[model samples]
Target: MRPQLRLLCDSSFRGPQRSRDVASILREVDELQAKEIVLVAQDLASYGKDRPDELGAGSIVDLVRQVSAKVPRTRLLYLYPSDLSDALIEAILDSGVPYFDLSLQHVSKPHLRRMRRWGDGERFLRRIADIRARAAQATFRSNFIVGYPGETEDDHDQLLSFVGEASLDWCGFFEYSPEEGTYALGLPDQVPVGLMHERIAELREMQDAITAAKRDELIDQTLEVLVDEPGIARSHHEAPQIDGIIRVPLTLPTGSFASVQIVDAQGPDLVAQGADSAS
Candidate 1:
């Protein structure tokens, strides 16, 4: 697996020279045969904070086009967020980028605030709705933290509720792992490991149900799958090289797209049925 080189420069209103600078850098990469490129927007507003209105969506579309035109074989991953307003998420989807990475950590609002992460579950849901509205065929993914300090049974249950509501195309469930230097580490009445593990199991179970429903929902939906190497067919939720894949019945042609249908769900992987293939 090749490491994805990400350009994190905040595109907020820095002006034309900035755009040119970015263009120049991309132009250099145009000459080199890079494996993959991911443009990550750390925050919503910051992604397009700089530049003129004309530079808004067109600029991103142009940038991605430039890269692809330069290196015809390069794959681009646009990491946007549903945490932003629906309009913004829609704009991102309308930018002609085929991939989007959203976020959702611990469906419980209280736990989210406690973690000092994005709040507004309703808005998050709305943004997801917007994504589906704009591009029903788009590939989407999100994350969730299982346990948090002071997270009660009610909170965990609330999170479970959200799992069903979100119907995330891809879901990542992580057990709360505390870091000593962080504020969560200093918070009182930390959840016990045993309890945390219990909660993690519960959350995973809920996520499994939600994921199954999502997979089932897409059973008849046509999806353009990027074929993988022999014995490896990855899910939409899995990050490249970081997640395991479903075993495909037949070897698949690398880098080619094949139409597939969701047939089964296995933890993080969605076993897809396509024209005999594996990646």
Candidate 2:
């Protein structure tokens, strides 16, 4: 029997800054025969902020390269800084990791400030464009919070418009939940729960269309999907469960790779036939 594992590397452990010995981890990964890796940096920019030898974006990029060279068969999924630079974007494109997730809570600049985020939606849109320019196959997903304190109709409009423009392949939205001892808990004009539900529905509706359209674009394109099960496959562009799975009609051994031609888009899932065989 072979050992199976998923490497989840966090930027912070017991503190806001901690340096991970990536080489050792990769060596272990090689020994374990893991096929996928997920890195949770929380805030990539601020990673290692407290320490003198901080693990920054460059470290992640280097890790990706090493993983590719050492375990070329493994695929990577990671959370990145919301505010991305061109160098960081290019490094990611070079790493051959197809998935990119950002924590874009709100679009309106005013709303973002309320959430303590720095950038405007326009900046984020530009970043998206940058990633798309470098890697057309890049899988983009993000998380958003709707119905925050002091949210107004215009703020929602901005967020919706941003979503329309961004056309993220997959997204998760939740009504803002007030947490104990959080700054948001005391903010004025807290959104009504009823309105929060309505907003969530509307955002989901808009995103559903965009996500469907994004999925439809992959038709006829051949992707080297990793067989996760007898009937399902996943490519670099598709993450497990959240981004949904690709349906491969033929039975294939799990943990194997097959070239699949996407033939159908059933909402978030894509139906695929082996590139070498009949559907």
Candidate 3:
């Protein structure tokens, strides 16, 4: 009824010095009466992998199991270090949280390397395949930055190809803005401002078509939606604010869950109704 709770998973939330007390955090969740949660692993796999013996695959597996057993309704906001280990992928699938919001900056490998990001477009597609094989209805979402320094025709084409191939259900493409003293500003072959706009426009058009097609596939499917506000509900596929929502006729209590039959998908948002009744 109240939507979800975004509880910090640990004290050093942004970086490596982890401190997560599962039971204590669950108590806070109960105090808040939150039915859903989002674990913000800003870049867990990256640092966690550095010392496998101490924070290895085993620890990740155990962590997933702990959270799944304790706070079963939580969703992970990210799975970073783009090339996910098999253990992490299996842990995620087993965790029952089917939504993924990857920080995949760009698809072009050269472009990605330039941006100081990990993973490439092809590897990401393979990861998607692996995830979808187990969780067919998984919602894949990601954000991309377009027109980085030194971006060329080939790089743009590579990203456009990824937009079509990634099968992302929801995505956002942002135009690159030069931040003062950022390393990106020092790179050569800076794209012209007008050309930068052109690249963003292309990515947008490509993703719109892909997102629309994917949403259309959800018609008539029964999904569990949490009523966050009056006449507004969100399924597992939908996140807060930035993502799409479901419009419902039922005046269900905010912060409660309901079984909804997806009636329509207009653009990114959806319209839903009670499974057994009309809207």
Highest-scoring model, lDDT: 3
Per-candidate TM vs. native?
A: 0.68, 0.87, 0.85
Model 1 lowest lDDT segment of ten: 11-20
Evaluate candidate 3 by giving its C-alpha RMSD to the native, one decimal: 3.5
Worst 10 residues of 2 by lDDT: 1-10
Instruction: Quote the lDDT for 251 in model 2.
Output: 64
lDDT of 2 by residue, 1-279 (tens): 111335434543334455457667677767867455444455543333344454544565556556666543434443444535565566556655567777788889998888887778898898888778878888888888988999999999999899998989889998999888778899999999999999999999999999999889999998887776667777877766667778885667777777878988888888886422222
Assess each prediction's global lDDT (C-alpha) against the native.
0.57, 0.72, 0.73
Best by TM-score: 2
- Over the stretch 1-279, how does candidate 1's per-residue lDDT look in tens digits? 222455544444323223434555576575444434445544333343356663553355445555555542333343434334444444444433434666566656677778776655676777667667877766666677766787878887877777778766556777778876667778876778898788778767776776566555655555545556654554443447544355444556654445666665555555666433333
Writing each residue's lDDT as its tens digit, candidate 3 over 216-249 gives 7888888888888778888878777768888876
Task: Mark the regions of model 2 whose C-alpha exceeds 4 Å error after superposition.
Answer: 1-17, 44-46, 54-57, 73-83, 274-279
Query: So what's the TM-score on candidate 3?
Result: 0.85
State residue 174's C-alpha deviation in candidate 2, in Å: 1.0
Q: Count the backbone clashes (under 3 Å) in each candidate.
A: 9, 0, 5
Residue pairs clashing in model 2 are: none
- Compare candidates 2 and 3 on lDDT and give the better one: 3
Error (Å) of candidate 3 at residue 240 is 1.9
